[model samples]
Target: MTDYSKELEIAKQAAQKGSEIIRNYTSNQNFNIELKGKNDLVTDADLETEKVILTHIRNVFPEDQIMAEESAGERRVPEARTWLVDPIDGTTNFAHGFPIYCVSVAMWEHGEPKVGVVLEVGRDQLFTAQKGRGARLNGSLIHISRITDPADSLIGTGFPYRDLHMVEHYLDLFEYLMHNTHGVRRPGSAAYDLCCVAAGYFDGFYEYSLNAWDVAAASLIIQEAGGEISDWEGDDNWLFGKRILAGNKVIHDFLLNAVEEHFTPEERKAEK
Candidate 1:
């Protein structure tokens, strides 16, 4: 059997170490910044944090494979164990001095996330979850909100910076939700958005075009916190797919139906 408690402890330590490195770099007056794409930003802090995280993970699990945002290596791993690392999930926010970024780390076994950790550096909050175990925030148990009515639920979403064509589809869904739900928020960070849903701060969240490292840790946390997660088609293939929706069971279904209605037959076929 997997020692989930031990794995959680190690992940927590690694995340804390990475958070400290990020915090220190944020105070530097002359930190280097680079643009990976149109709206994707990277900084010295991101690379430094990844170094700290990878070193810690390698020290503990030498043979495990690593899938990280900054690494140029391939993600394929013939072994059963792998680590997903997003040293800084909100690099754009971090570069702009926004406090909504985090260090997300997850361990996968047999192709599923088995251990997850998300450390919000700005707030010093640690969120963790292990397969079969409940989720926690700062060592306190968490659960999804009990809201059932879409009119009273607050939802969250992230827009893809790389693809502008998808923006119209996203906006259509957003417009529908804005009129039906209580409110909607765009936090610009998928990892932080999932953490908020796990903590019951948001009733639901959905987004399109996200990478594995962006949602691997947060998805497990939401699942362990008594929330539901799936792709836009209301399926379980969230890890590899570009679309995701997460919320309490009731709200998740409601959001899924609304999202489906926003896409036309041709749009749906094009997405496929």
Candidate 2:
């Protein structure tokens, strides 16, 4: 069995340290921004925060492998423990001085997330989860919203970079959800979106074309907060598949069914 308490402490410390780096850089009057891809962006803050988080993780868990957004070296390390890190979950928002970004850290043991942390830097809100231990925001326990009716629930989602071919399909899904739900929010940060769901700020969240580092940490938070998580197909292996739907139990099944109903044959083939 994994030492989840120790792992959670390490993840919390790493996220807090990374958040400090982000807070310091965000306050600076001038910072450099760069494009990682078409619409995907990076800033000096992202790299600096990654460096700090990796340094801290290595100092305490030197033998563990690392998969990070800014500096991922290899896919597999022939080890039992792997750390997934996203220094800044909402780079575009952070670059534009928006306060919705966060630092996410998760540890995977035997291919499952065992502990996770998502730190909302500007707000100083630290969300954490350990398997079987429950989830917390700041220092208090959190739970998903109890809203059962989709029409009465506020939902959150993300739009992937335009060039990805699924953009149109995603838009269709977004439009459908917008008309069906009370309100829909695109926060540009998957980690923040899931954290919001865990904290009951958003009743549900779904998105396509996300990376493992993007959802690994926040998924644990949602599940531990008495919410449900799954792939677009309503499967549990969301980490590897790059698609996710999360919400409280009452709405999770309903939302998944709605999403499945809209998947065209072509879209299904593309997913495959």
Candidate 3:
């Protein structure tokens, strides 16, 4: 078995470095903004933070492949193992100074995420996990909420900002959850949302049209936190299938049932 302590620490430091860069831009508001797509954005913070984080990782593990949002095109090695990075997971939130963005790092050894680290910068919360070592929030062990009943659950989700073709069907699913769960929150960050569910802060989270960089880290953290994660079809293809439903077992299945009913086979596929 691989020892992931060093990997976890490096991922944590990368996130911390990213947090500093994010806070700098948050206060100064002196960054160039780019429209990556309709309603999807990127900022200087995303690029700079990605640079620093990748620099540190390269210094330590030069052989590991990296797939970060801003700089992957500039620096990519053959993939034996890979590092996934979302320098600023909630760019819109960061650009607007909404204070809900984060840095996410995940180490994929072989093909699966072996360690995950996500720091909610504004909140000063660090959520981490190594495969087989239970998930943690700021060094304390965490677990999914045990509320097995659907009606009592608090769910979380994010809208497909880049692709709205399925908006009507997504709304149908959202409306069902709104009337069913205690409440639903679209906090504009998928990494943070997944950690919130892992910490039992929310009972479940589901979303579609997400990049692997957005959920790779948080997915491992959620699993190690005693939570369940899967695609809309209740399968393991979430990373690229573009659909995810995560929570305790009961709540996951409950959400999956709704998703299977609402999203058709074509809608479930990742946007090309």
Name the best candidate (by lDDT): 3
What is the alpha-carbon RMSD of candidate 2 to the true structure?
2.0
Of 2 and 3, the candidate ranking higher by TM-score: 3
Model 2 lDDT-worst window of ten: 263-272
Backbone collisions counted per model: 0, 0, 0
164-266: candidate 2 lDDT, tens digit per residue: 7777667777788879888789888899999999999999988877788898899889989999999877777577566788999867887787777776644
- In candidate 1, what are the lDDT values of residues 13-79, reduced to their tens digit? 9999999899898877457999888887888888989999999989988988889899837634334
Which candidate's TM-score is highest?
Answer: 3
Q: Which run of 10 residues does model 1 get worst, by summed lDDT?
A: 263-272
What are the Cα lDDT values of the candidates? Answer: 0.86, 0.85, 0.90
Quality of model 2 by C-alpha lDDT? 0.85
lDDT for 225 (candidate 3): 92
In candidate 2, position 161 carries an lDDT of 80
lDDT of 2 at 209: 75
- Could you tell me the lDDT of residue 92 within candidate 1? 85
